[model samples]
Target chain A: MKGSSPLVRPGAPGRAGGPDTTRQAGHRATGTGSRRAARSERLAPYVLVAPAVLIILGLRLYPLILGVNFSFTGDGDRNGMVVGLDNYLELADDPLFRTALGNVGLLVLLLPVAVAIPGLLATFIYLRVPGHRVFRSVYFFPAVLSPVIVGSIFNLMLAFDGPLNTVLGTIGIGPVDWLGDPGVTMFTVVGVHVWATFGMALVVFLAGFSTLDSSLLDAAQMDGASLARTIWHVVIPSLSRTIAFVLVTTMIGMLTSMFGLLYVMTSGGPEGSTYLPEYYIWIQQGQMNRPALASAASTVLFLIMLVVGLAQVGLLRRAGRQD
Target chain B: MKQRTLWSAVLVAGLTVSGCGSATRTAPSPAGSGTSSKLVVWDWKSGDATAASYIEKAKADFAKKHPDVTVEFVAQPFDQYYTLLGTAIQSSTGPDVMLFNGGGQLRDRVDALLPIDEYVAEDRQRLAGWDAFSKDGKVYAAPVTLQGHPIYYNKEVYEKAGLDPAKPPATWDELMTDCAAVKKAGKSCFALGNKEGFGIQFFLSGLGSGVLTPQEYDDWIAGKRDWTSPHVKQIFTLWKDVNDKGYNNPGANSTAMFNDSWAIFQSGKAANVIGLMSDIGHWKDFGEFLPPDKIGVMPAPVVTDGATPSLAYDGGIGYGVAKWTKDPKLAADLVRSLTSTEALTAFYAKAGAIASDTTIDASQSGPAAGAIVSAIKGGKPALHVALSSKTLDLMGRVSQKLLSGSLTVDKAMDQMAAADKAS
Candidate 1:
């Protein structure tokens, strides 16, 4: 009865009366199998994410490295040959590129306004203002539209002879060349960009509002706090992280995502006053056959975004700590 | 033919698969070594509704010559055509034949193209505007359409201004007087759009003949441009003067030269526009809004003494075989079919282009087209076309600045001279 039992199998490792050679072989096999299982368990996370990591490396990082390398090479007759900072020197001398960089600075200065409109709108919605549901949907509507469509629609609305000017004329106000004035065109484009994209930021803010401890807002109200005071004291601190996220994102959007609008409306014109780095890169690479110069411009843009993003994060963290 | 069709199916399948990969990963065999049954072409026009019949006629002509060979025309967006072509060139894989704008666009990328002069020798006598598609006496592409800047005036506006519509201005003074009358009639003297900087191109070329001595005009086209010359400065100064005197449509800096400026002229808001002989801003397009007889074509008014006015035209667009093609002869044959008289006549009829084929009858298009045709013999290469792409681009920007009063003509002339010299 003992020999027929499963536990009494002769070759099982660590059995009380097993033979030495067979038992030793079984013990080694068990050790090897357990070690293999442990190693496989250790590798599971990486194995699960291998495809994604590979994809990111191949598609994003590899091309980025290639592009940075390409920036140092020559274009046209000297193509594929290393030129050692010649493209960067050329970019420095280009007035159009300089205008583009200046526009980037303008965008950075305007970032707070871009973030605040949505924050305020989300606060109003969260407060259950009149027709809050309708306002939420209405505000989010523009975000769903393609930039090309928005740009085209605005082009019609903002032209010198367009409906906007006509309305201004009826109001006894002088008509303004919204898209024509070099001094005003970049502001006009940024204004439109803010309008179109503020919806997405508002949604992010509303989500942040959902996580906010409503008790603090209620406490402020109970203390006879004014709406402005409550927002400045309680709500701003509560949504500090959200504001930081929105600020960095909005800045990135302005720097990178204005190409479609720029392409459709003004085309970086009015004496190159509306030029952005992306549009400048496109013009150099596509129109002027200076891909290396475009690459240099692109690298500069990337560096600007990096520095600005890191600075914003550091500033926001310090502000949050003070709060 | 069935085998050719099967081969076409395979080629399409191959292209579809290859298109999914990076251009470098799927480099196709050159036409000289690959199967000759299928030829791929890239153009901005083939997809246009107007170019349908022209494409069909050309396809039929090509089919007659190589009945066993299949042709695939890939229509690309004009805005991104050159960019995409550059990518293909860098990867060493693309269409067998591609379309190019005749001047700087073609010249800037000649290394990617095969010279078709030997193949198109038979076409020399028949085609006009060959010089535009030629560089250093070697033709790279076959001319398809003739493009020129023609001053188009609205007869109705001229009549409203109490001027003879039949007789347009013949000198700078006459133009100014006509413009004054137009302003009095509450209409703009010119429909101008400098948004994309193309308005300046039309302006310089349209009025160049009027301001420059005939010798200077020829010299400029012959690559001896003197950007600092007094006549050159006058063109920029007069451009600013027109805007300063309220002779152009308001917000000239914002309006696009394409349909926007054309719309101003068509809507009777402006008396005249320096327009094109072919493409969107031509007499045919203007005729769409105004009656054909209401549009009048006139030479540029003389702005300087000893200046002789004539049309400024060149090859508008053309098709060339790529150097990497396995069968240059077959691709060149496709180019020939694309430029054939029958196909061009269809193109002219359907697309309203001034066909590059000189023998094609254009009298039926309109009197404006007729006038353009008559002036062809005296026409010269466009002044702006003579400048390098860099200079042309700078000129466009400065022209906008000049109109905005942010830049001076002297400063613009200096910048232009420097850019030209650099090129």
Candidate 2:
């Protein structure tokens, strides 16, 4: 040990010893190098993931926590002062907020129709319907257009004295107040939203269709099954996971993505019947200068989404197990 | 070792960006640490084709005072202006100067605004609509234009209906008779758009003077409102009655007060509208469609016997200095330049704003503008402007319900009363 030089390589001639001493030195040096390499290998994964973790912490989780904390603070004269559940209490008492929550329920009820339209279209396309290529593009076209453009287009078409009403008149039917009737405005907006977004879901369904077991369909066909029966027996069972994914994603889209349409189409009008929680949050923060109250509404919305998402996953898993 | 160093550098870079994003910026020095080479101004009007000359004139005026300082005017969309301003206020980092609507909008965000009273004192006598931008006896902004709700009518429609276009309705009965004739002539009596719940405010302020007695009107403006008063009830009742009687254009609830209601009037589909005096939907906008001679500004027809109608006016818009500005004096000077006579006159001539500068000549702005100018001396603050932002919003929603027959007048009044009281 005393005679060995620091710069001496394991294989290089060193000291009076020949190949035996050199081989022993080589193993000693190699052991230290391997230990260092192993340490680097262990840390590589953490280094790779560090940026994404920082981004999520900085952009998402931090703001979410800040918003929840801000919800407890006061606005205006009492700004920055904690007011406990005062903002939440105010949200509960507000009729417009109540209406917003009620509309969320309505959107939930309409979620099945929204998912099915896309699922059906995707199926047709997957089955190689005539002009399928064109249909695929045409269906997805609206998805590319901004909600503002769609809302503006629909406003002209759905106006009381608009072309749709004129067509109804020619057909000997009375005009329907598509956007003006409180009872019908929410439905009209939802219908437009579905029309605008179904293409996206359709694409997802088609992607799901790609992985479908062709043999199952062929077996159903051999059993003399009708188209609908075959679809129910073969395609649906095979695409259960896809169906679950669509259901969860579609619900989330309805809850979050309808803001632009609501803003342009109704502005939560016809007696605030079309107010969604997101719109309500905008009104509170933007219009009414009640950011604290808006944050409370946001927290409530987050909880609602969390509960809805969890329940959906639980149900889908149970159904999968039964199947 | 090199790979580990590179990865470490990448991690440091990523964290650095995130740290900058999450860090709270230090408040800008109130005394202006040093004179900023540039000043940023935010307004919805600066981008308009009509307001281009006005903006140029304002910039020129600003340049005269500080040739070295550059002023950047950011024309935000009016829909998102307040929301953006609120975000700016929260972050304590926004334009040095920003535009604000009169009354509740200015009042609510006074915490973020620098009081420019001393800076704007010289322009006080020249400008007309100061009360609207003042909160708690302190001025947060300088008035740029006098916004008023003037009942504008199409003279050509009157001619087609065989009614005297010159002699517009002066009482409730005459208005009803005229509306009947207009209806028979296949034209709507009013071009109303309540989609944003804004139409109700215009309607309330435009027609309020005709229903409430002068004393009651004064009391209401002074915050001594009686929402259950017979006159107040009549205002809401008349709104419903007018809609029920087929006076407003069909689907009024769905119609937007913005370019839509304005469009309805412009296209000659409706005879009359409660139009603005500043910004859009004014005599200038109407003049663009109808012949200048065909646009008429009529006083509100008396709805009650004791009622004495007067114009409802307020500060339409004004620019205020932000509290976070590096240089308050510089920002205030910029605001003053924005409202200078040369700038406001250009604004009036091009944008057709009823310039808040009282001495701005209105002779070339056509007869309707002339009438508006004449009525300003007797104009009262807008009734809607007297209410809090929350109440005004609630009134908008309830007004739609009242028009749709979902809520009775009594029920609507109760809601308004509660909202007014709470706000």
| Residue runs of model 1 more than 4 Å from their true location after superposition | A1-26, A125-133, A208-227, A312-323, B1-17, B20-41, B59-80, B83-97, B324-334
> Tens digits of per-residue lDDT for model 1 on B1-423?
112222433464455445534433433444466444677888899999999999999999999999978888888777757756766876668788889999878887888889998899999988889888888878999999999999999999999999999999999999999999999999999999888999999999999899999999999988898888889889988999999999999988889887899999999999999999888899899988998889999999988899999999999999988998878898999999999999999999889889899888878877898888888878888998888788888888899889888888888888889999998
Q: Which regions in candidate 2 have their CA more than 4 angstroms from the true location?
A: A1-37, A122-137, A206-235, A315-323, B1-49, B55-98, B111-122, B321-338
> What lDDT is reached at residue A231 by model 2?
81
Best by TM-score: 1
**Model 2 interface RMSD, in angstroms?**
11.0
| TM-scores of all predicted structures | 0.88, 0.86
What would the C-alpha RMSD of candidate 2 be, to one decimal place?
A: 7.5
RMSD per model, one decimal: 7.6, 7.5
Interface RMSD for each predicted structure: 12.0, 11.0
